[model samples]
Target: MQDLLDKIVAEANVTPEQAAKTLDVIKEYIVEKFPMLGGAVENLLGGNN
Candidate 1:
């Protein structure tokens, strides 16, 4: 994820926190639409399923 943050910072000209938040929102959107992926997302987040 550090690589992604670096890319976002360089290409999008955004802070690490902003990039992380954007990624989180996008991931949550996908999870909400495709609940089956909730498991994978939860695993990736290392949080509750």
Candidate 2:
């Protein structure tokens, strides 16, 4: 998770905190909209699914 966050921060030229918050919002949206695919997305995002 840290690795991906770092990559995003570098590539997007954003702060680490901003990257993290963006990821959190995206994760929440994905899990909410696609309830059935939540586990798969969570796994891909490095969550314990």
- Runs of candidate 1 with Cα error greater than 4 angstroms are 42-49
Worst 10 residues of 2 by lDDT: 40-49
TM-score of each: 0.69, 0.79
Candidate 2 collision pairs: none
Report the lDDT tens digits of candidate 2 across residue range 18-43: 99888888888888898998988778
Residue 16 lDDT (model 1): 83
How far in Å is the alpha carbon of 20 misplaced in model 1? 1.0
Q: For candidate 1, what is the lDDT? A: 0.76
CA lDDT of each prediction against the hidden true structure: 0.76, 0.84
Query: In candidate 1, which residue pairs clash?
Result: none
Please provide, for model 1 over 1-49, each residue's C-alpha lDDT reduced to its tens digit, 9 standing for 90 to 100: 5676689888998888888787788778978899999888776653421
lDDT of 2: 0.84
Q: Which stretches of candidate 2 lie over 4 Å from their true place?
A: 47-49
Model 2 residue 42 CA deviation (Å) reads 2.1
